[model samples]
Target: MVSGHLFHCRKNSWPPEEYVGRTALQLLDLDGGSPPEQAWRRRLNSHANILKEFSVTFMEAMKMMTLGVRLWSYVREEASHGRKAPIDPFTRERCKPSASQGVPLGGMGSGSISRGFRGEFKNWHIIPGLCENSPVMENQFSIFVSRDSGNKKYSSVLAPGHHEGLKKCNDSGISSWDWNLSGQHSTYHALFPRAWTIYDGEPDPDLKISCRQISPFIPHDYKDSSLPASVFVYTLVNTGRDRAKVSLLMTWANSIGGFSHHSGGHFNEPFIGDDGVSGVLLHHKTAKDNPPVTFSIAACETQNVSVTVLPVFGLSGENHVSAKEMWDTMSKDGHFSRENFNAGCSMPSSSGETLCAAVSASTWVEPHGRCTVAFALAWSSPKVKFQKGCTYNRRYTEFYGTSERSSSINLVHDALTKYRLWEEEIEKWQDPILKDEKLPEWYKFTLFNELYFLVAGGTVWTGQDRTLDLNSPASTSC
Candidate 1:
C-alpha cells in the first residue's frame, strides 16, 4: 500500500543561524484543560517571518480543535544550478491536497503516512513550514484532529525536529508527557527516550549505535517531562557484528522529481519474485540540497548492505569509517554487479510522471543477530508542473535490480508490502502493548506514544532568515 514520493535535501542542511525568531509549533491540552488550555496555545511565531499557519487549539472530548501549518523553509545563500545548497526548500508554495483524497497526514490502521509515522515519532520533515521568511527546517509535520462534533482524524506526526534519529535536545524539548487530544484512549503523545545525545563534538570514535522505542501504555498523568521523550519501545542494537549499519535520512518538501522512490526488503526465493533490497541511496537533479532540499536514505537493516546512488559531490563521508571505501565507491560508479544481488529500495513504477515522496526500511541480520528495521514515510504537496531540464543521471545504480541512481525517473515504484511491513506493524502494535505490563526481556521492546502525554517546550531545528533580501530575486518575496 504505497505510492510515489521523493527525497533530496541539503542547502547546508537548512541552518539559518539556528533559525531566527523561533516558535515553530505549540498546541496544547493536557487533560486538565479549561483555561482555554492555558488560554489558546498556538505559538507559531510571526512578526514578519510571515510563514505562519500553526493554529492548533486542542481539546478532545471536551471539543474545540484546530490544526494548521501554512509551512516554512526557503534557504538560498549560494550554490544555484549545480546545487548542494542555495534554494529548493521545496518551492512552489505548498498547499496541494487532492491525490485521490490521500495525505492529510495519511494515517489509520497501521497509521501509514505511507510508512512513516503513527506513533513514537522520529526526526520527520515536511518542507520547512513552507518558508516565506525563509531559512527553515522542520522534523515532523501532519496532524489534523478536529472536534466540534467529530469526523476529522489524523493523530500522529506532530512537532518533532532535531533529526538523525534523535538522541538529545534538551533546553525544553520537554518530554514528561502531556501530548494532546484529551486522551480518550490516546490520539497523540510523543517522547521516546530511554537515553539521549545524537552526536556533537567529533566522534573521535563512537559508533556502535543504540535506539530504543516501542513502549506505549500511558497513565500516571501520562508521566509529564524530565526529558527522554516519554519512552517508546525502540531497539537498535549492534554489539559485536563488525560492520554495522543504521541509517535514516529524510528531507522532503513539495516534490515531483521523476516519480520519487524508496521502499524496503523483499528477497522472496523459490519461485523467483526478485524485488532486490539494499541500504539508502538517492541522487537526483545534480546532487542538490545543502539548500537545494529533497532527500531520502533510510537504510536500517540489510545484511551487510551494499546499495548505491551517488553524485552529491560524489560523497566524501571519508568512507564513513571505511566499509571498504563505502563498497569501493559504490563499485566505481559503474553501479555494482553480481547481477543485482538481492536489490531493493525504491519501488513503484508505471511511468506516469509527476512524483516525489519517499521513505525506506530493510533488515537482514546474522553474525550476532538482533535485527529490527521499521521505517515509514508518506508525502504529497502536489500542484506541480515544472519544466525543469537536468533531472538526474537518467538512473544508474540504487541497489540495481534495474540499474538507476539518477532517473528510473528519480524514485517511485509503487509498493505492495515488503520491508517486513515494519516488523509486521511492530507485532501488531507490540502485542496490545504487551497486554499492559510484564516487562523484563531487556524491558520488553519499550513503549509509549499515543502522543505519550506531551509537555514538550522545545523543537525549532536551526534557523536564520532575518527575512531575506540577499541582494535580489525581487528582494526574496515568497
Candidate 2:
C-alpha cells in the first residue's frame, strides 16, 4: 500500500532563476479537472491512510505522493509534445524511458500491472523517435523511476483522456529488430592480399659485386618499380675428419614465371676458406674428383631470390657456408660491373622526374667467429655531369709542422716590416735627401709644377682667379 499524488505543477519551482521567469506558469501548472485543490487534498489524505495501514510513516507516504506527482506531472507535460523528460542537466540532451518499464517479467505478481502502467506512461510521455537505452536516457531514468506511485486514489487523479492517444500509439508498433544485436553474428567480406618478399644475403653488397637479373623480367604489381635489382650469393666450407664425398642441391624461382631452376646433388670438395669471403682455404675432389664449389644465377624483376646452403657429408665431413661473406667478396672484387650497379631507369609520370636509390644488407657469421661485410647503394640523376681536368686550390700549406697561409693581415704585416727595414737602412746611410726637412722654394715649386703636369698630362696657365685656361680647344673642358 502506497500513498502519493500523481499531478504535475504548472511549472517546476526548482528550475534555475533565469528559467523560472522565462517559462509561462500556465504551461507548467496541471489542470486535474475541476475541484483541483479539494480533489488533491482528499487524494493525499487517502494515500496517507493506505500507507499507515501498511505500517509506513505518514511523512514517508507524503513524500512518496509528492514524488509521484512530480514524475506524473513531468510525464503529462512531456507526453503533450511526445517527450519523456526535460534534457539532462549534465548531458544537456533529451532522452527516452526504458523499454524494460513496458516489458512484463514472468512469475512476478505485479509485473504485468507495472509493465502496463510503464507502457502507458512511456508511449504518452516520452519523446517520439528517441532511443530509450541510450547512455543519456539510462542516466536520467535511474533518477525518475525509483519513487513509489503512492495510493491508487492519487494515481487515479491522472487524466485518462490525456493518456488515451499515447496508449494507442504504443499498442500500434513492435520493437525494431537488428541482426547485429546478437553477439554471435558477423559479416564476411573480401579483401586484397598483402604479400612480402624475402631474400638471402645482403640485397646490396660491395660496389664491386655484380648481380645479374635472374628470374622474372617484369616487376610484380605489389613491388615498387623504382627498387634496384639485386643478387644472392651462397658459399660453403667443408671441415670433415675423413675423406668425404657429398653432393649439393640448389633451387630458385621467379615471381612471374614461378620456380625456374633446380640442381641435383653435385659432388662437393673438402674446402675451408675456399667457400668463405676470407681466410686460408682448402678443397677436395670426389671420385669424379671435380667438386662444384660456386654457383650463381640471375634474379627476376618481380620476385626476390633466395639461397640455402647444406653439406652432403656427415659430422666427420662437416662444412659451413656464409652467404653474406660470399656477397661481400664478390662486391669488393668488382664482380658487379659499373653498368649493372648503376641502372638509371626512368620514373613514371605520376612519380615526376625525381630520382631515388634503395640499398639493403644482411650479414651472417659462424658463432664464435669474426666476420665483416659492407654493402652500399649510390644513385644520382642521369643529367648530372662530371668535370674533367679539375684542379684543387688550397689556401693553406703545411710547413715546419704548422699551417702557413696568406691573408690580408699577413700581407699588411709583411709590407710594414719591409718598409721599416728600408727606413733603417736609409737612416744608417744618412743620405742628405733623407735628412733634409725642407727644400729651396724654387726647387719645391718646380717639383709641384712637374707633379701637376704628370697628373694633368698637359700644359695650362693659371690666372689670378686660379682658374686654368688650356691652349688646346679640345682641352678647354678639362
Candidate 3:
C-alpha cells in the first residue's frame, strides 16, 4: 500500500440573514432612491411574485428558489453522517452497442448494407427505409489462394466462423462453410462512404489481402450518391518466394426484403456487360405496372485478372452439393470448376431453396507482386411501395429513370465507371475538416462518422415537388 493517507475536512458556514433571501431590487442595489423612485420600486417588487409565477410553475419556482439552500443543507447533512452525496442515478448508466458495428455500405435514401467491425456482413437494408437484422449466411466475401502451381491451398469466408449450424443436412452432405479469419489479426477502418479491412495472413501465411469498400455517398453529388450500389476493391500482395494464384469471391443471395417476395417471380440469369464486366442479374417481380426490380453482382476483368460467374447456387441445406462444389473449386486452384457454373440453373419452388450467386476474380501474383480485383453490387428497386397503400419512385430514379427505363446492369456499369469521381468529391468534402488544427482530433472523426445515421437510419427520399413561380399572374393558383 502507498504511504499517503486520505483525510476529510469540513467547514461549518452559513450566509448572513440579510443576504439569504434577497429580492431583485435588493440584489441590483436599487433600494437607495428618491421617495417617488422608492414607491415605483416597491410597486415593481409587489408584482415580482406574479411575474415569477408567469415564468414558472409553483413547484418549479420553489425548487429554483430553494436549490442553493437545499444543496447546502444536504451536503452538510451528508458530511455529518461521514459520507459524500450519492452520484446521480441518471449518470450511473449509459447506452452502448452490443457489438462492434460501424460504417454502413450504401448512400442516403438508397438503402444500405451493415457490416460488423469483424468483417461479418450483418444486416441487409435493400428496401428503402427498412432493415433486416438477421445475417444472410451465404452473403459473404471469401478468398482462395494456391501457391507453387496448386501444391498448397488456402480458402475461407474471411470472418470468424458462425456458432449456428445448418438448417439441415442436404443431399450432398456438406455441413458448413469455412468462416476462418480471427478479428485479432484483421483491422477495419471506416469513414462514411469508404471502409478498409486489412487481412494479415493469419491462416494463409503466404499472401495478405486488403479490401477497400466504397459507396457513392459523396456530399453534394446527389445523382451518383443516391444510387443503391457499392464497390469492393481487393488488393492482394504476395510476400513469399513462389507465385500465388488468388481468387476473390463475392457471394450474395437473391433475397432483398422478406416483404417483397410475396408474388414469387424471382429468377437469375448470366449477364456479360460492356466493360468485360460479367455476373448474374437477380430479377424480382414487383407489383404495379412498373418494371420488375433487378439486382446484379459483377466483377471487372482487367489484363491480368479473369472474372468467373456462378449464376445460381443454394444458400445452404438440401443443396450441400452447391456449397461443397463451390468450396472445392475455389480451394483446388483458386477458381471455380467449369462445370459449377449454370449447372443447377433452376427456379426456387419452395421456401427451403433460396438462390444465391457467386462471382470470382482470379489472378496470379508473382513473388513480391501486388494485384487488385474489383467487384460491384448494384440494385434497381425503382418503386417504393408501402404495406397498405401509396407508391412512389425513389429519388435516384430522377437521374436514372424508373425500373422500365433502367436495370441493375446499368447501375453496375455506372458505379464502376464513376466511382473515382465519387472518391474525389468525398476527399474534397472531408479534407478541410481533417486538416484543421483548431478542431480536436476526436471531433474530426465524430464529424463525418456521425453522418452514417442519416443514410442508414431508414431514411426515405422521393422526387422533388413542382414549384410555382409567384412573379407571374398565370403562375398564381386560386
Candidate 4:
C-alpha cells in the first residue's frame, strides 16, 4: 500500500481538463475502439464549433486542424499488409518494352538489357521498382549536383529537369515522374505520386529498362535513434511483355563526378566479398600531394535481387575499351565468369589521368519483373579501412531482412498495396480537405464540436427553461 501510494497514479481516472463536464466513465463510452469514424467525429464537433465561432491564434487553430485531419484518415490494420496485384493501376494498355538482341555481358555471367523502345503508350507512375527511405534539406550531395531541396524525396528520382522529361516521355516513349503525400498520414503518403525515369531506345523484343524512385520511411527505432549514418536509395527494374526472362547490364557513371564524365571513370580497386556483395575502393590525390581520401560503392544482392559486378579493362598500352565491345567479344558463348582477363582489373595511374577504369554489374530478371540494387556510399580516409560488402545488408536490416529477403520485399510491397486501395478514397476527399468548395474550412470543425458536446455530456445546449402547470381537481385521502 505504501509503495503504491508513493509511486503510482490511478490508471482508470480521466486526465484533468480546464473545462470539464463528463465523468471518466462517460468519456470512455463515447470515444472507445475508434468505433465508426463518423460516429467519433460527431463527438468532437461541439468544441470545434466554439473554436470556429471565435478567432484564435494560428497555433491553437492548427492543433484543432491536426486532430480533425487524423480522425478523417480512418485507416485499419488489415488493409496495410495486403497482397500486391500483378498489374499496375496507372499503365495505359500494357507495357511491351522492346530492345536490340544485344550480346551478353562479358565476364559478368549475365546478358545486357539495353535501353530500348518502351511501348507507344505508358503511365510513368505506378510502374515497378522497390524503394526505401526519404531525404529532404540541403546535404552535401544535394548542394552541389542535386538541387532538389524542399521537394519530396520521391520526386528526386526523376530527371532533375522535370519539364523536358515529360516531353521526351511523350515524343519518344521516355518519361520521368515521382510520388507525394501530405497532411500527415501513412496511408495518405502511400497515395502520393510515384515518379521514375524511362530510357526507351528502340523497338526490340529482346530487352527493356525502367527506373522508379522511392522514399522509404525508416522504422521508429532507426529514425529516432542516433545511428550516425545516412542511407540514399535508388531502384530500377527490367520489364518485358513477351518473354519470361531478361538481363540488365548497367555501367555506372563516375559516381563521384555526377552523371556526365564517363571516359575518366570515377571507380577503381574492385573486390568481391562473401554473400552476394561486391565493392570498389576509390582513392586518388592531386599533383600537389593532397591528402588521400576514400569513397566506396558496396553492392548487395538479396534473393529476388542478385547482382554480378565485373571489372572493365582494355588491350595492352590502350587506356580503356567500350563496354559494348567488351560485352560482344567476351560473351560470344552467351556466358562468362571471373576467370576472364578483366575480372579484377583497376586503373593503373599516379598522375590520375591515364588508366581510368569503369566498373559495371548485371542481373538476370524475369520478363516484366524487377531487380533492386542498393549501394552504400561512405567516406573513410586512407587511415581507416573500407567497410565490407555485407555491411550494407546489415545496416539496412529492414530492407535486406532479418531472416529472409521475402520479409524485406513485403515491407514496401504491402505499403504500395495500401496506397492502391486508398487511391479512390483520396480522390473523393481531396476537395473537401482542401477547404475550397465542398465545405468551408470552419464548418468541419464546428460539426466536430457539436458531436463532442453530445458525447461528453448534455451540458452545452440542452434545453432547461422553467415552467409550471396548474390542476383544478383534487381527490379525498384514502
Off by over 4 Å in 4: 1-195, 198-241, 252-267, 286-290, 302-306, 312-324, 327-336, 340-347, 350-364, 367-478
**Candidate with best TM-score:** 3
lDDT of 1 by residue, 373-421 (tens): 3322222211111112212210111122223222111222111123233
Clashing pairs for predicted structure model 3, backbone only? none
> Which of 1 and 2 is the better model by TM-score?
1
Candidate ranking (TM-score, best to worst): 3, 4, 1, 2
lDDT per residue as tens, model 2, 1-478 = 3222112111221223212111112221221101111111111001112111135688987878876676667547646764334222222233222211211111100000011211121111111112222111000000000001211110011111232222221211111101011101101100000000111111111101111111101213111111111111212111212221111111111000101011223222111111121110001111121211111111111112111221221111113122223223232331223232333222211111111111122232222211222111101110101011122211111111111111211211222223223223423432343235674423322221122121121221121212222332112111
Better of 3 and 4 by TM-score: 3
| C-alpha local distance difference test of each model | 0.22, 0.18, 0.59, 0.25
Positional deviation of residue 219's Cα in model 2 after best superposition, in angstroms: 47
Q: Where does candidate 1 have its weakest 10-residue lDDT segment?
A: 32-41
Task: Point out the worst 10-residue segment of candidate 4 by lDDT.
Answer: 102-111
Could you tally the backbone clashes for each prediction?
Answer: 103, 31, 0, 34
lDDT of 2: 0.18
Q: Which scores higher on lDDT, 3 or 4? A: 3
TM-score, cand. 3: 0.71
Ranking by lDDT: 3, 4, 1, 2
